[model samples]
Target: MIRRNVLLLGLGAVLATTFPALALDRALTPEETQLIQQIGAHNSAIRTMAGRFLQVDSQGGRTEGTFFLERPNKVRFRYNPPSREEIISVGRGFYVINRKDQTQYAYPQDRIPLRNFLGDKIDLLTANIVDVTSSDAYMAVTISDDTPIGVVQVGLIFDKQTLDLAQWTLTEPSGAELTFSLYDIQKDVQIPKSYFYIDPTYKAVQPK
Candidate 1:
């Protein structure tokens, strides 16, 4: 299951680096700033999201998958293409099911690196700005947490004109990165609550 998260992280890291920034001279106008604030605010309040994921690693490996995310802390990753596995988080607990082995692993969410990565109270823009720059096409902001073991840095790229989030990256402490690009991002989309529940039959494995 950690492999699954690592794969997703790799994808997000690559996508986050691909989107180049716009020209530096083009400062963000008041209107553009307002738009960015609104977008950030809206995203902060988003309760759930479903999207396609494409993750690439520094080693030239790639994985594609689908993800379901519920804010304030619930997420599920269904990886396809190279392998089959499911990772689901229910509140403070998480579960990983290995389809090939017909096994499951359970652990407290706080014990995993992903818990800090998927924090609900965080807003990519307002949370903290590590650095900000712009190019002819977009503006980029790098953000990171101050933790030791849980440290992760994210780069947010936004369209220069539209100020919409074009892409973002999640970089793990081990130097692994995952990039996530948003397409047709729908805010406040109704996601069924049942998606977060773990099946009762699967035996839970104690974390090592």
Candidate 2:
């Protein structure tokens, strides 16, 4: 499962790298708007997702992991292969346990990027869409947001056939990128309430 997550993440990074040129002059066509609307509609009601993710850093290092996500705020990531680690987020805070170090780190939800993964209010179409383009294979939407950390670019890739989200990329202000791919997606799945609670045994640490 961890391998699956890493793979998904890698896929996302690949797609993000494929974004159209920043200086392109094409505007969002009617067809593109319709497709975007369709994609948004299909995902609007989705409340939970569980899958494997593979993440590759800019340096080409790779890690595989399994992840669980519940909308409006909750997620868990378990990395595997050589090292085992678990990071989970309740609605208001996040906790990470490093098995090797026997250390735990906890922080407010807003302090981490995980906050963005747990909400539906984030609308890509209405955001700062910098560019839009389409090909026979997929529709690409590029957007950016200004945050205290800096401007972050988000690229959304949608399958041309299904109009579903194939992947997304987040380009940090520092030029680092994190991507996510969705596969074996289960929508509206029932997740237990307890899944959002932090374990009491884990020590809590304040965010810097």
The top-ranked prediction according to lDDT is 2
Instruction: Give a tens-digit lDDT track for model 1, residues 130-168.
Output: 446557877666555433335556666777666455666
Worst 10 residues of 2 by lDDT: 2-11
Per-residue lDDT value at 164 in model 1: 55
Each model's lDDT comes to: 0.59, 0.60
**After TM-score superposition, what is the CA distance of residue 161 in candidate 1 from its true location, in Å?**
5.2
Best of the candidates, TM-score:
2
Instruction: Report the C-alpha lDDT of model 2 over 1-208, residue by residue, as the tens digit.
Output: 1222121211123344544444436667788778877766665566787777665555666676777777777777777757656777776656666556566666555544434335665455555566776778988777655543555566677787876667766676567666666667666677777655555666655332
lDDT of 1 at 198: 73
